[model samples]
Target: MSLSLFIKYIHLFALGLLGCYLLRYYGDLNPVLASVLCGLLFSFLPFQSFIKSTKGQGAIYAGTFAAMSSSRVLNSINDFVLVCILGGLILTLFEGRFEGLGGRKGMIAFLAVAAFYMYRSVL
Candidate 1:
């Protein structure tokens, strides 16, 4: 990736982890509500760059889904962070492949979580 794109990816990854943290620990701890709140927050962000970057949005949304994972599925905050990063990378890789398909974001999130589990068990 180009230098700018790599930096943007890092930024998205951090935002994704933040989204996961907020969803998992914030008041009420409701994934649906937290995701909606995040969506709303993104909608109102003053930065046009974020508003226009679908990948950034997808990364955050994927992290929201990742946070929805149970403690049984993801043992610790470190695991959550890793899974969210995996999710963001998967989301970036799968971008445009599922364009116009609803729920692709959720699928990408699921893939990330599942991949982490599988990876853990295999090695």
Candidate 2:
């Protein structure tokens, strides 16, 4: 197999293992549960259809949600709400008119959330 493909598979395997570990050890954690629930809800919700309807928006939303799920501060509803709003605003402001590029919005959202978390940690 090509090096890139091997690396991709390895990364996927690692992620799968990590997810299993989290489910086993932190399954009872409220924040972890909330993130999972929110992720499911977002995937199924009709309102989020707009995101899927637009390629770039979908990417941004997915990226943001993924980042939020990985966040350490998403333990409370208030924190989650704030993060979501902040991510949304960042995408709206910086993503410009490219609304149909698949995953672009998600990438933007992920970066914004990551930046926010980094900033918070430094403060």
Clash totals for all models, in order?
0, 5
Q: Model 1: which residue pairs collide?
A: none
Look at candidate 2 and tell me the lDDT of residue 66.
42
Candidate 2, residues 43-84, lDDT tens digits: the string is: 565543443344333433343344434545444545544555
Tens digits of lDDT, candidate 1, 37-121:
7766765777657535777676666666665766687777667667766765675566569788898877877888899889888
For each candidate in the order shown, give its overall lDDT on alpha carbons.
0.67, 0.45
Assess every candidate by TM-score: 0.76, 0.44
Worst 10 residues of 1 by lDDT: 1-10
Look at candidate 2 and give me any clashing residue pairs. Answer: 56-101, 59-103, 59-106, 60-105, 60-106
lDDT of prediction 1: 0.67
